[model samples]
Target: MKIKTKSKKVNKAWLHDHVTDPYVRLAQKEGYRARAAYKLKEIDEELHLLKPGQLVVDLGAAPGAWSQYVRRKFAPRDAAGGGAAVGALNGTVIALDLLDFEPIEGVHFIQGDFREEAVLAELQAAVNGRPVDVVISDMAPNLSGIEVSDAARIAHLVELAVEFSQQHLRPDGALVCKVFHGSGYSQLVDLFRSSFRTVKPIKPKASRDKSSETFLVGRGLKQQA
Candidate 1:
């Protein structure tokens, strides 16, 4: 049928594009888990989100390229600061996801749905009462082929990330999360504005031009009166 043919064509086009993308080739060359590492790299260059000795939580951290980048950038080095060993890194990274991901050297990974209370509790316990300096979320719900429904699902995940940051992040900490620009977008921005002293939206160069996805960085959580 025509529908099947159209689907096949679309798949082929995506495959071709993936094969040719400069970021993909660069990721392979650099040993990153995926091309998405470039997207986070670009954002971090602008924001300086990762720092030495920071405790970070990565939500929806499957495929773990972001965590890998964090480890390489902030992981504690030997006294000489010459080696790339993971366990000696200066900071801690706790990554959570619904899907299984291959282990990263310096990252502690938890597998579970982030929306559940039990999972949240486990994540908090993993932090072990440490003040989280940064929380990053790149979670996206499985699309149902309905735009509105998809938007709502993604929005809910964003909200959960925001709420978790509000509760767990240090007063001067930051949150970086991936969000789409449609439907509940404005409300999410407003939520960030209300909770943090500064909120900025970033669209990294590595992100696909046709995608509506953007990163929201919320910095300096306001003290509750």
Candidate 2:
């Protein structure tokens, strides 16, 4: 009974916070699928990583708020198309996730586990030989509440994103990946430093104050990696 009561209280607290979150209200007004779009928007505003006509790969892109944000960036800035959804997209977006998402116009969707070789092959095929201008990963493994295990899971996903970036991103392209600040965090930072000419860690205001998540942006891959 105590466990159930505690769980219920936690749920209520989270619900209240979500309802009161300004980002959530703004997302509803802007037609984004989730509040997460603001997080990417803030990061892009800070870094200027996204641009028109770029080919982007989105990893762990379920619920697709980030993709929606990118779509808006690619929206043509003409009288009829400016800031409109499904209007003349000036870029390419390919999104992959373990869970299926509702279709977004002008975005290709793939459903698969990213850790598998076959899925990676399919993702590459979808790229269709174009040099990716940016790769963004928000992938995080399902947490089991074991700190060590969770940290390893997070590190593995980040590492895979790095490897993919090394193989597919343009020499001057960027990779943005979500990583938690805990065990193995420094090692991930070191990995980024070794792989990219520039690395930055960004925590967006849309992210919850208590969340450990931060984004690592790696740009301009170094040779001999």
Candidate 3:
């Protein structure tokens, strides 16, 4: 009888790549909660997406890096006397995801599915009926590796993000959503165009070149309210 050993060569390779990745090291150095911070930071730098004191909403804000960034930008400061003073025009951020997140200052975290009406209602309440200045959605479906199915699911999430933006975004507000290049991408882009004055597709520096994921930045949202 021969005994066979299983070599976790692939797992080792993955760990090696992750450990050596520059973004991972940067995240640690910068005190970010996750490496995803670089992704949004790169996107914002290129797009000029976020502003101090602008109300923002974060979709799929788990692990809280994105929330942390938004919170810092909009976090309230103490006034001269003692009370909290308005920082950045008293900007507000509402962060939502299916998984619960530890609270970040200036961010109201809502743990729920965005597709649910109750969740949307909760998000609306968090916004307090104020039109949002920017909406950033990094939602992705739990990959099943069935390309078509996964693409469709992610596309649906993009749709929900767009719908939420329509209801919550102010005139000239912007939206950034992560979408995969497959199945219904074109249709989704078309919808975005119809709702925004400018819709551009972007592959940020932090995004892996091998990955099909990209962000759609929709600017100048049409205000129905």
Candidate 4:
């Protein structure tokens, strides 16, 4: 009973912090699905990751906030003299997640476990032979509350994301993924270094100050000599 009370207090504290978070309020005012949109937005602004007419794949895109940001960025506008309709962005966004996601404008969603070969094949089919310009993964495994176990699970997902990027991204394509600072972090960084010509680690301002999560942005895939 005492443990339950303590858990409730922790939950309430988290809820309080979330409600008062500036990004959360901003997201609500701007119609974004979640505060995560600001994180992507900050990353995009600094890295110039998204461009018109590019093909992007989003892994672990649930609640559709990341996809929403991509859609808005590429969505054709009259000033650009591009396609004059919603979802008519000069680009395509293919989103995949293990959980079912609500639809987002101008995004193709695949529902399944991304680690499965069948799901990977489906994602490839959705690409329709177009070379991917960028791949973004915000997927994190459900935490087991054990630090070592959690870090291992996170590392596995990061490995899978990197492997998928290697297989599908164009020679000059880029990858951005979420990772935590813990066991296997250095190895994952080494993997990115080997795969990409330039690797950068970024922690967006919207990311919580207390969180150990950071994003790795890799650009210019290296071709085998």
Candidate 5:
């Protein structure tokens, strides 16, 4: 007789859902680390962020898809538009996350908690005293299912990202961060408005319709100075 176990049903259900997930198929075909790449790509298309030979900082950049996009975008090209060798001093992308990620071409990976001062210092040092052109934070707290607590944690992280942007971004740089629409959402938008010349909230097509997550883009950092 075959043995029955409760785990089998759960596993089957998970497999079914994963298999039917459109993003999963799309990611496989496109070679993105996660479906999240589409979200960044959509935002970039709308905002025209990311340029050749610019300094970019990516927070919570594990899996390295975003870094991959950055690398391709800044790949060396000749005046005739031929693919050229990437110079040692070309554009730089620094990816930071608590989880380990395999290194990608043209990306410097730092495995550490972004909340730590040491990690931030190392990232800053990597930039070699030059202000970053763009900062993207995809950081999200582990959900506990407690609405208020989760919102607070998310808000705190957004605040930390804001503070980092204020300190490290160039006057004309930009910041894009993931935020959930929950308690303190409006206040967070207000804070960003005060800090940046323009604040635009974006929801990418790659994002699940049921999700509360949105991306806040702060532009024209020079206004604060």
Candidate 6:
């Protein structure tokens, strides 16, 4: 009885906060599918990582808010960049996720788990030997509340993202990976530092204040061979 009551209170509190979130309201007004778009926007604006005519790979990209943002940036537009919603896109966006979403204009979507070898092969084939300008991964494991196991899953996803970047990203390309602040956080940062010439850790305001999530941006890959 006590547990049920506590759970109800927690749900109510979360709902209230989500309803009043400014980013959520802004996302709806601007035609984004989710509030997550602004998180990537803030990160992109800070680093200037996105540009027209670039080939971008989005991993764990369900719902596709990040891909949408990149699509808009690639579109030739007026000063506000709101002139055209979906027209001729100048860039390539390949998105992969385990869950399916309604198709977006000019985005190639692959539905599969990224951890599987077959899925990885499909994603690589989609690249078609093009120089990937950026590899953005928002992959996250279903949390079980066991810190050790959860941390391992998180680390594994980030490691795979880094490895893919090493193989596919252009020498001057960048990688944006989502990571939580807990066990193994520092190791991920170190991995990024070792692989890229420049590594930055950014915490976007659009991310909830209570969330432990942060982003690691690694640019300009180091020589591997």
88 Cα displacement, candidate 4 (Å): 2.9
Show where candidate 6 strays beyond 4 Å: 78-83
**What TM-score would every model get versus the actual structure?**
0.94, 0.98, 0.87, 0.94, 0.87, 0.97
lDDT tens digits by residue: candidate 6, 83-112: 245888888999999999989899999999
Q: List lDDT for all candidates, in order.
A: 0.89, 0.94, 0.82, 0.89, 0.84, 0.93
lDDT minimum window of 10 residues, candidate 1? 76-85
Report the C-alpha displacement of residue 124, candidate 1, in angstroms: 0.6
User: What TM-score number comes out for model 6?
Assistant: 0.97
Which stretches of candidate 3 lie above 4 Å from their native place?
1-7, 75-90, 223-225
Candidate 4 global CA lDDT score: 0.89
* Lowest-sum lDDT 10-residue window in model 4: 78-87
Clashes of each: 3, 0, 1, 0, 1, 0
For candidate 4, write residues 1-225 as lDDT tens digits: 999999999999999999999999999987888999989899999989998889999999998888888888786766356423253667899999999977877789999998899998999899988889999999999999898899889988988988888888998899999999888889889989998999999999999999989999999888745
Give a tens-digit lDDT track for model 1, residues 1-225.
999999999999999999999999999988888999998889888989888789999999999998988888775555457226355777898999999999988789999999999999999999988889999999999989787898889889988998899889999899999999888899889889988999999999999999999999999998766
Q: Is candidate 1 or candidate 2 better by TM-score?
A: 2
Regions of model 4 farther than 4 Å from truth: 79-87
**Top of the candidates by TM-score:** 2
Any residue pairs clashing in model 4, and if so which? none
Candidate 3, residue 89: Cα displacement in angstroms equals 9.0
Looking at candidate 5, what is the lDDT of residue 96? 93
Those runs of model 1 whose alpha carbons end farther than 4 Å from true positions after fitting are 76-87
Better of 1 and 4 by TM-score: 1
Q: Which ranges of candidate 2 are over 4 A from the true structure?
A: 79-81
Which lDDT value does model 6 have at 194? Answer: 93
Q: After superposition, how far is residue 82 of candidate 1 from its true place, in Å?
A: 6.0
Residues 1-225 of candidate 3: C-alpha lDDT, one tens digit per residue: 122223466667778988998888988987788888888888888888887679899999998988777665554455333223233335777889999977776577899999999998888888988889999998998999887888778878988899888888888899999888877889888989888999999887777767788889999986544
Better of 4 and 6 by TM-score: 6
Candidate 5 lDDT by residue in tens digits, 1-225: 134456787789778977887887887887778878888889999999988889999998988777777766677665236223233335888999999987776688999988889998888788788888999999998999998998898888889998889988988889999999888899889989988999999999888887899999998764555
Candidate 4's displacement at residue 15, Å, is 1.2
